[model samples]
Target: MMILSWRRRRGGHRTTKAAFSEENLSTNLAIPTHFLCPISLDLMKDPVTLPTGITYDRESIEKWIETGNQTCPVTNQVLKTFDQIPNHVIRRMIQDWCVENRARGVERIPTPRIPVAPRDVLEICSNIMTATQRGDHKKCMELVEKIKRWGRESERNKKCIVENGSGYVLSALFESFSSISIEEHKFLLGETLSLLIRMLPLGSEGQSNLGSASSLRCMAWFLKEKNLSSCQNAVLALKELLGLDEKHVNAFAEIEGVEEALVKIVKEQICPKSTKASLMVISHLISSSTSSENTISRFLELGLVSMVLEILVGSERGMTEKALSVLDTICNWEQGIVKARAHALTMPVLVKKILRVSILATDLSVSAILKLCKSQEGGGDQQVEALQLGGFHKLLVVLQVGCGEKTKEKATELLKLLNQHRGRLDCFDSSMDFKYLKRPSL
Candidate 1:
């Protein structure tokens, strides 16, 4: 990294280096651009090569890794490890240049500290658990902060934390903090649960440690926090746990306040991340095989149908997909069908969503409509309302155009139901001509 100094002038002329003595280059020396690290854009004091074969100054690269970047700054290649190998030749060259320019005011850069070792991380985790056992909440938080920082520092550090018992320690911390019933400890409990969520990639063993009912309660408590980060992380952690196994999903059904918390979060629309996470939590609950009945019943009791319709009417494609998915699940149950039909916007939103958002939305929308219209013979007045609302035309267009097989089947079944009641009205089989179809106000 010994850089030659070349000064660019107004006319693009570089001042000659001939003015410099061999003993001291000018401190005002314009460093060569290549001599700078790609990330920090400063001289490479301790250069290191990533797996991508690109080099960066050690501190900048380590900070990037600590911030959870998985790719090289220059090449954008996935880094196998943040364990960067030192470019000794570059370091020596930088030192020599610094020595040469010492008389001119350039100071030599100090070497970087060594990377944290796995044994040290293990020791921290061991200390964390011991502190927790001794009821040392203050020391526990300090230890947890250390582990959190280490985990965020690099993927290697995260793996080390999980392997060195950080996950279990965090889980135990969650359990202990949640059971105390102290108001002040709530913040610490939320933080602990948040850490558990950050370590979710540790897979089944890590997920299992978080399966306690007390942990779920801790998340539910977080849902009530004024802090948006805590709420969002709690939602995310719940979603992650539900995704891990059926037992976990079923466990959610037993949690008394979670369904209501999620509904409130969705209705509040705090942020896109929290709303999406809350919707996903509801989706998983409804879609789970063993828990669908109980989950749907509880959601309906919480007036989830009305809240979902509100979300669906104005949501974008992503929200629409999840809303429709939950709606589709709800529509299959008798209680759900009763609630949906009772909702004023359910029919119109269902009709409007078909072919309006995405194929997945279309599929879920079609399934919901089929269930609603087919629940009774000729779908009763629902069929007439659908035809009057332009749902008849939408179903026909669904059949005429491209869609998935299940969507097509549901559409055909719905069309037959609409046709069964078509004779009652002056409606026509105007599947081909768009001009003949009168759109409903809804």
Candidate 2:
């Protein structure tokens, strides 16, 4: 055994390294237990020592803490503090071990960059403020790039950047640059928007700062950008801001081509997150606006109904819930209902989603089907289609499995409507078993 020791610290704490030799290394080329992170059981890279005297990889420990876990992973003891001290000695030992085992294909771990502290983030924010005040565009861009790098380094760094007030600073920069020519500041604007999106769930102050009409227009402009990330960020940012109040939602709806832009994003399927964000923004606009009828009409003109049904056919749970929600809101208007009922996939997709997604999704799906079946325009056809699509069985299953009072009411009403055509449709059998349908796990 190769004995290794270190001097004792003033607190009477001693640090020791694992002792290993060639004979032990050749046995299955085993890794020393101490070199492995307790959390991941992988060789430690950037090991950090917790107050519990247990060492873990920095990324693993930070993620554990960020997820609301306060207890040590190995010891199960409540952590007194979240501070993680770098275990330089262990990191060096791991590096040396990797180097000695290079012939055996062991790769060395690179040194980790020091994590940004709150003070470092605050200093960067200060520089951005000063640069903006001086109209030093070059200096501001440089600092923005540095901030972006820090934001991408780690979740902890991103949290530090956000907690240190980067949201307000970035919003101010975004608004200030909105006045410039698009060609002149397009890159900076995109970067600023990207950083802002990273600091989402912006506080009241940040939302207030970004809620201006000019800022809303700027965001709309980004929705038309050719860059996918910028477009996604723009819609996501709008979703967060508009959700804060009815006034913001109403204001955003008034922007020219806003509905068209959102419709295009959904139709093109820019990405799932962006598509969902756009759906949410549309839901807020139609559901919250004082002039909802006009807003719904505008969305219908932009082909919103068809795009939403296309999404519902293949979307996962969260996306399906959002799309169904938007469809339900849109169906409040006569034109919206007519457009939805006209689609071939609308009834089938709505029925397929029932009891398949979460309770919220089931509620939205049932609500949309209810609106389509009750509408005066082609309402009979919709009810007939529901009966043909096995919606009757799903509605029965919905009631048996239990749902919200409102959902239960909607399901009851829908079942009544579909039952009117039960004998006319061959899909419903008199001897069918209701006890065999799959129930959603509670």
Model 1 over residues 81-174: C-alpha lDDT tens digits? 7667888777777777766765554556666544567779778868877887888889988887777777676676666666666776787777
User: After superposing candidate 2, which stretches have Cα over 4 Å from the reference?
Assistant: 1-109, 180-182, 418-442
lDDT of 2: 0.82
lDDT of 2 by residue, 88-176 (tens): 99999999987886554445678998899887988988999888887778988999999988878887778788889999998887777
Backbone-clash count (model 1): 1
Off by over 4 Å in 1: 1-42, 48-117, 151-165, 179-184, 287-298, 400-402, 430-442
The deviation in Å at residue 386 for candidate 2 is 2.8
Error of 1 at 337 (Å): 1.3
Point out the worst 10-residue segment of candidate 1 by lDDT. Answer: 6-15
Candidate 2 has what TM-score? Answer: 0.76
Global lDDT of each candidate: 0.76, 0.82
